[model samples]
Target chain A: MEIGAEAIVQNQTPKRAAVTTGADRPGRRPSSGRFRRLNVLVGVLSIPLFIILWELTSRSGIVNMVLFPPPTVVAAAVLEWMRSGQFFWDVAASLYRVTAGFLLGSALGVLLGILTGQFPVVSSLLSPLFQILRPIPPIAFVPIVILWFGLSEAGKLFLVVWGVFFTVWLSTHIGVQKVDRGLIRAALMLGTPRRQMLQEIILLGALPYIVVGLRTAVSISFYTLVAAELAGTFAGVVYRIEIAQQNLQTGQVMGGLAALGLISFIADRLFAALAERTVWWR
Target chain B: MSGYRSTTKLALASSQPSVKTVSEQPAIQVSNLSIVFDTNRGQMIAVDRVSFDVAAGEFVCIVGPSGCGKSTVLNTIAGLEVPFEGEILVEGSPVGHPRPDIGMVFQQPHLFPWKSVRRNIAHGPRMLGKSAKEAGAIADDLIAMIGLKRFADAYPNTLSGGMQQRVAIARALANEPRVLLMDEPFGALDAQTRAVMQDNLLELRDRIKATIVFVTHDIDEAIVLADRVLIMSAGPGRILREIAVNLPRPRSSAILIEPTYLALKRDCLEVIRAEGLRAFNQSDSS
Candidate 1:
């Protein structure tokens, strides 16, 4: 009886395999493979195709060449800016402002977030005030910041810091509050002291959210950097963009915009890589 | 077996002296333990004056249907539940806060996702101010006991459910608590894995010798693992009956097929079915 059952099973196996392979091969597999290859080809051509179209549009006089510079003209302008040594100084100044403001803002935000998230009294005292101020755009503070600091570096720092602070603070606050109560209870049962509870359990538990907040603050820092430099700056990429716009050096303006985009893109990618490392478990 | 005992001894040396003095007292005492929760409707009684004692080194299982507050009672003993009207003493002291002497394994394992198996097991010792080296040594011993030495450096997410729960059990044991409370630790696993884990736990229990109060709804599981099974009724939960298991030790889930085990299970199910029918009829009439 067992040998007969085994013989029947062996006979049935090839038929099922043949049926599946026959179905998969003729219609499904090759078409899907071809479609996937087409997708890859299209993705690879995407940016170059856009650049060629942009170049043709500018040269064809569909738009003013001066205002809508060709990619070649933008590239030339970027090269010229680099050759003049101003590009290095502009990048340095912008980097300094963003890094300093981001560090100070995120530090304060995390400290206050832990305080407000952990203690109801602290939340009651500061949360209402923070909620009121958080909705107002940091760019709106440009005028007030200029009046307070009068074109000094401090005014620029203040604007960027303001922009970065709220996002980090809100996310951190929510993250801390959302930490698994089970984890806290488990930690408590294991005899974790109050201080160690915060440092080891609460902080680490909320870290993924905190990292997300900091990444968002990275972009917010860039956005505020634009507003700050446009308000007033001695040397920065946005300042150079403004100068180029006034002079009708449209190519240079476009180049500066491209430079800013590239820098922000790099910053975001860097932050994303750092975020993966920050929340290593995920 | 000898290596396991000595390692446990060295790890528990600090607390060993206190154990002898309190040997006569029950490891856990819950007297008139009533817990009420304020739901949206009104004050709902989760546990209604339920009381029990687990003697030193005894294995007790609280079996009940869902919402019967078996877990709440276990949590109360672990000091994770509060604002209850009653008294609880662990190792002869009134339980209010979670003491290091009482370790709990929650249903979901609740292993720290960020830490490796070894590090997760090491956490309790580290929290109690043992040096890093001491904690690592303690964790390694548990890692071997649980038979997860190969996965010691693995993160919680990488392990299978049974393995993760094993690590959680090991982590709870790291502190060498006098009382170990488990709240349906195997409830979430598949049937095959759950049976294996039950057998593994029975084996581990012999060596650990900690007073264990396990809460579960599985009758077969309770009969397989416990020295005494407390059957609880739902809706303003209270203990319906207590059945003592006279099953021999060095037992496995294989004994689940034994005539004696089936008899004990039948007694539990009868009490549960009677209460369940009464509850259903009363609700239907209302």
Candidate 2:
């Protein structure tokens, strides 16, 4: 009976192999290639198609032109803003806030994260406090920040820093905790001193996680920037948008929003490129 | 296997004589070593009164079934295991913390992924306060010794399993430790690669004068590598017997076919089978 079963299996094996090989033959190749090409074509046309539809709707009286202006009108307003030279200053102001706040927040986050992750005593003291604060949205603190700083740059910086700090801290903490025990044992066996263990092994082990946290904080800095500007800023992209909104310059307001989105997108991409280099071995 | 036999023969032919010395104190002395872990089921004994002494420049293999606390014994000797009832003296000093004279290789390579092969090897020397130049020189020497000179700058992730294990061994030796502890270092490799690694290790062992204690479940590996093979039984690990392999030096996996080797292997199998049967009966009765 076993021999007969084996014979049946042997007979079916060639048929199964033939069917799979037939499916992989050259006759099926062009359809897959054509499908991939069609996907690329659709992807290339996606943004342009959306813009054209938006423009058509605005101009064809389907929407209020003043409120929902076309992309061309927004572009012209941006060009006008650039011609006046205020665009550069607005970008510089916003860039300065994001950069300063991100650096300060990331530094603090990493420091505290290493402290809490390494020592259980420190973790016991700080983790509970952090857990409480981490869930409260950074935007919610804007009103309180305004009351405290009264439109000062300190308040704006505080908002952005608060937004970035928790993300970086949590990831760094988890990363340090998740560092392989085998690696630690190996390092210990190699006579790695306690101080050097933290500096060399622990820090580098947690770096990949820290980079991930910092990347997340990049987008978060933009989110908090919105809150900070709305709270009250002298000059920033969001501030310009607010001013345009009040003056009823809908095109300028739309242009400001576009500029903000572009900056955030660029920041995310730049950090992603940097992150790849940061964890170079990956 | 046949391809590596020639290289093994060549390595043995060119290898220097063993530097085994009759020093006053043994390289490692473990007396009455016991470890207890507080698991969900009250307290469980991991190692029970395990005692052994490895002589200077001696190669010893501890062979046992999995969860036999053989690794725990190795770790305790390396000063990585704590809160255990034991007196482990390495070179006449009681083991408490990881010392510079001791080096260990784990089951996994555990090579710092961020570091290149050269840098990973240099890490031990650098931590010991050797200057970058000195550390680099040491790393380069070991890299050449391991025959991975071409891949000195390559990262661990890029290397094959056997190659990574070689680098790991080189890294452990970078400090020129007096005693080296290895816990199933080639257990993760395929059989073919494992044979090659064993041959490479035998060749490398000829040059380095460090006392080595290797742990494995493979009786064949233990016999091929060690001057003394310590057989251990699990369920609160304890040594069952110690068999001395009187095989000639500069040996490799090629000796598996030899009459004396087969006799020694039969002895080890009888001991292990008796232990396994006893444990099986005890568990069944329970």
Candidate 3:
């Protein structure tokens, strides 16, 4: 890639600003621009470096190619999976599970969180239940889920929902609790009608935290998906990985891991993009 | 300056003898008002026995120390807080709960983040059974009057603090309320912005010909904006003294530098100063 001189000049105004200020101004736009650029460069360079090291290790026989496989082999397997439509099916299945689970869990979480956060009586009543159950991991609930719903997609979905619920619920509850008292007072003094008070002041005040929780919930969905798949079904990418490990196809196992990582990254990026667009006011 | 000039023009035009006959009724009447809040320990008197009548089209400022319950008085009048004693009668009827006829502004702008400036301003009008067309017109007029026409569509976050408060003022006026209750509405702003907002408020008050009960801790602010300044004592907050600021109509920022303005400020300070000293002595002893 040829670097344009104007592009370099555009970038180097920071070089001018840096020499001018004795120390960089913190959190200011132009001052942070340099660090942002550096982070992007570091991120872009990481994959290539990993691939090069893998190829070098394969060629030098430092690691057996048959055991670990090179990046090219993994890429080829990914391409074959895509060609066979198995990759799309697996991705679609994972996406559906995450979407259904997160939406169901977060909807319930927000409603309960808002109710608890607003009224002290409600909070006290629910806090005990949350405290007791919150310590039990969603993975631990897999047995109960299976017992209740059978060892099927329903059980897997239940596990994922349970995993995401507490995360979103706690964040929203804390958010509503910590809403700026001044803002609430302002609304009340303005003679805001009672019914609209929660919707306008409380919920909107808690929105930024809810969004952060929603972002965190995506990670929880992936966590629960892999765990539930590993424990329950004889299908899903995790199941395929388990089967591959049993048959001693290490490359196929790594391939499954790569798919999981890709799905998580893409989903997170999409969610973050939505949040940035939606909650710019915060 | 343009703001006050327009207000003067409106006042002149609306000061017809027939107009006084048409709207001679008092906007708000607070008779024997007192507020006591029940905290965890016991009943705490926030506002002690107080009574005042705000005539239609008068600007009143209640000034005191930080904990003097100036805000409690405003909240009581607004019907947000129930007073332990006394009646706040608006237009000859007691205020039992919040009504659309009363508008309030607070220290924080409190503009809803989800709504644009225009939408926030239009909220009260729309809530009061006005059509979108009517609400939009009122919102537009208020926005223009507050000098925020250019920022009508902007979200609250995009605006400066002063601009956000301007939107808040516009929002309050949209209700076409008979009275405006403000509780340290400009106290949160920087000194420069606060000064500008004070000017804007006084100008708006003059133009609207609406009764305003403004609460603030700053004596200079009280003298600058008030037609009558009421000084309050702390702890079981009670009105200590009331002074009619007899400065000429359409006062400006330059009025603050006048000897009379300074004298009035000192008098108001003396009232709050005694309370301040007593508070400090109590704290020191404790």
Full candidate order by lDDT, most accurate first:
2, 1, 3
**What TM-score would each prediction reach against the true structure?**
0.92, 0.93, 0.87
lDDT of 1 at A223: 96
Predicted candidate 3 versus true structure: per-residue lDDT over A7-80, tens digit per residue: 76679998888876646654577758889999999999998998999878886878888888887887787677
lDDT of 1 by residue, B207-279 (tens): 6868899999999889898988999999899999999888876688889889988888889888989999999
State the TM-score for model 2: 0.93
* Chain B TM-score, all predictions listed: 0.92, 0.94, 0.91
Question: Comparing candidate 2 with candidate 3, which one achieves the higher lDDT?
Answer: 2
lDDT of 1 by residue, A38-114 (tens): 99999999999999999999999889999899999999999999999999999999999999999999998999999
Maximum-lDDT candidate: 2
Computed on C-alpha atoms, the DockQ of candidate 2 is 0.46
The number of clashing residue pairs in model 3 is 0
- In model 1, which residue pairs have backbone atoms overlapping below 3 Å? none
Give the top-scoring candidate (DockQ).
1
Docking class of 1: acceptable
Predicted structure 1: lDDT: 0.90
Better of 2 and 3 by DockQ: 2
Q: Identify the runs in model 3 with alpha carbons over 4 angstroms from their true place.
A: A1-43, A119-121, A181-192, B1-25, B39-42, B273-286
Query: On residues A1-282, what C-alpha lDDT tens digit does candidate 2 reach at each position?
Result: 223445878999999988997877858778999999999999999999999998999899989999999999989999999999999999999999999999999999999999999999999999999999999999999889988999999999999999999999999999999898888888888878887888888988888999999999999999999999998888999999999999999999999999999999999999999999999998
